[model samples]
Target: MANSSSTRGTSLDPRARRTRALLRAAVLDLSTEKDLDSITMSDIAQRAEVNRATVYLHYKDREDLLLDATESTMEGVVEAARACRLSVDTHALPDATPTHLISLFAQVDQHRAVYRQMLGEDGSARCATRLEHLLAQAWFEQLTAEPPGSPHETALQVRAHFLSGAVLAVIGRWTRGDFDGEGEDGGGGGGGNGNGNGMSVAEVADLTWALIRGQK
Candidate 1:
């Protein structure tokens, strides 16, 4: 399947771009209110203020549009992970979570609803797979940038995939409220504002970094 990057440089007429933007926004808005499985093409069209035919003209199906809509949300995560300094010397790692890592969790928290829906049991495999690949690619780049004694290509690939999958799993569970009340402050839960009682972004980021650095 074509990845989200496939559409990056493809030029669309101004009108077409506007229509796509509207449709993407409409779907994202609707997703927060209901399950993705229950949302129909006609519903998306109505929300976008376009006819049903217009929706089909832009996307092959609801999932295709959803993929497009949610694609932008992952960019912050990949960029933040790439910027992180995953030091090999555990002793050298900062006690506090890196700002980039915090940003990564904040990005995910900002879109908690969409992510919870997409990464849930009934969520889209394509979406999860795409995110995993992007994250793995970012980690692979970092590993390759290490000094001459770095791991072999196969080892790097394995480590990258493992790290990315672990990160995604944490994100998935956090969004699903599995970590609620464990590491959270007394703040209440509701808005995806990262201030919720269920594992704040900083707490998750700290835990994730601790695990990454092999700290107890």
Candidate 2:
């Protein structure tokens, strides 16, 4: 699962890297065409223009290939969050929170398709669980070194999981078209009149921050 270090190690020669990249891209493209359950190692290998045996050399099976393909996007999310946390801690960012948070959301927007497949109803629960765990761990680290004071260990765990879950839930909905265009809230309050796709990256970031800060 955590292949980041190994990926940079000697095991990944130039040819190996190219093969893996091709496999990942092929899986993603094929996913857009058909259900993941129907996808097989042969399908992926064929799409990547590689033999089935070659796929077996790099990945154990179809699930392995799918996870590897998705993890890159998830890693990007974590890395962006890490950078944002560092910026906040170092006071290097001008608007600190919002700017970096927006950047993180922008990265999410970039990988929305991947997230949709991983976190959606018919997708892999393993991928969603792993992403949540990573995000929660990152938040736990960030919260432990804060000013207003860190929570008790148990509370910190709860807070971290809650934060991660909340963020991902919102993101899943956003990417799934939950906030597309305008709709009344039954109170007849006018809607955002959005483009009917979803919130802009900035809007999502702003909304995310407000939620984190416990603001309306």
Candidate 3:
């Protein structure tokens, strides 16, 4: 009992937590402001006010650091998604709507650099995969009331995975500024903003849910 408490307390120590925050903030700040190719360990150290050696101790290379940063951001998104699920039941939340989802997506657009980096040539598909996994886990916990082998379970899981991927894909495109006529977001072949008005996350969310549920 003593040992377990000691371990837990150590993990919660202030200085140790601060060091991690510094390193994580340094990586994300640099990523947000510059392309991944241009960032360096020394640059991160300087931005973070830490030593290069310290950075090395926490991460193996630029790729590793970028991955770590991306995961950190996903934690919040996953939580929001989980909340979306809970809101559906605990509060008799209204059916998922496109407008609301699109608005959440627009918030993601606010971090174009981070999303772009995740989908860019130098970025890690692994980060995207893990994020999808998180979203799937949240959805599964809520959407699946039966055991895995039930008649409808497999189908639902597949649909969940597909929905998660679609969400990520749209966000990826948005980050790259590819929403053609999609307001300030990029667009190479994007159709005019949904319904010809300014882009909206709520609309996208509604559309996405429609697709996932096969609704008209």
Candidate 4:
């Protein structure tokens, strides 16, 4: 594995940035057609219209590039989830769309194909583990940021881990079309923009909030 420091930098030059983008795009495109394990550096380079050595210059290796792309997408997911925590009023009832929840879903939807492949049954364990680790870390930070709620440190850690795992599982299921259009949310289907089944994003948020608050 690469040290990350060797390949990761504070900033990328324009040409470097362009090349990186191309390589990333290539990986994403190829991922849709083939499994990540089968997709080699040569495949990525060819798709990106670059040389094998060029791909090496930008990324440490195939796994490194895949992780980079996965993290980039997860960044948006984490940002949206964090925003939902901060912005949504836990006290107040949820609206149909639930701004933050939909925003989170939209981020996933934007990269639906990538997520589906990575989170699928035959998905990469490394990618799933990385996502779980990041999610747990984010939730742990969120839990600790507020005033003390849990009596024991261990309990808090457990709760955070539980929430993170549950959330990831839900998202994975949703990507697999488990909840498509089916809104268990009592009210009518989507808040107009929801899926055909009318599952309101707010309903999903409320359910998540309920679990979170109950555990607290």
Count of clashes, each model: 0, 0, 16, 4
**What lDDT does model 3 reach?**
0.62
By lDDT, the best candidate is 1
TM-score per candidate, in order? 0.89, 0.80, 0.71, 0.76
* Pairs in clash, predicted candidate 1: none
The residue-by-residue lDDT of candidate 3 on 41-79, one tens digit each, is 899889989888877765667667666666667765666
For model 2, what is the alpha-carbon lDDT of residue 51? 95
Q: Per-residue lDDT for 1-216 in model 4, tens only? A: 222336867578999988888888887888667666678999988999999999889888788888776766787777666565431123443433346666776676666657766877777777877777767766666556655453366655776677678877876666555565432222122332365453345555566666655423
Query: Which should have the higher lDDT, number 1 or number 3?
Result: 1
Error of 1 at 105 (Å): 0.7
Higher-scoring candidate on lDDT, 3 or 4: 4
Candidate achieving higher TM-score, 2 or 3: 2
Off by over 4 Å in 1: 1-9, 88-92, 181-195
What C-alpha lDDT do the candidate models reach, one value each? 0.79, 0.69, 0.62, 0.66
Q: Which ranking of candidates, highest lDDT first?
A: 1, 2, 4, 3
Clashing pairs for model 2 are: none
**Sequence-dependent TM-score of model 2:** 0.80
* Candidate 1 lDDT, 124-186, residue by residue in tens: 788888899999998888877778876687888898899999999998878777777432222
Q: Order the candidates by TM-score, highest first — what do you get? A: 1, 2, 4, 3
Candidate 3: stretches off by over 4 Å: 1-12, 86-107, 146-152, 181-198
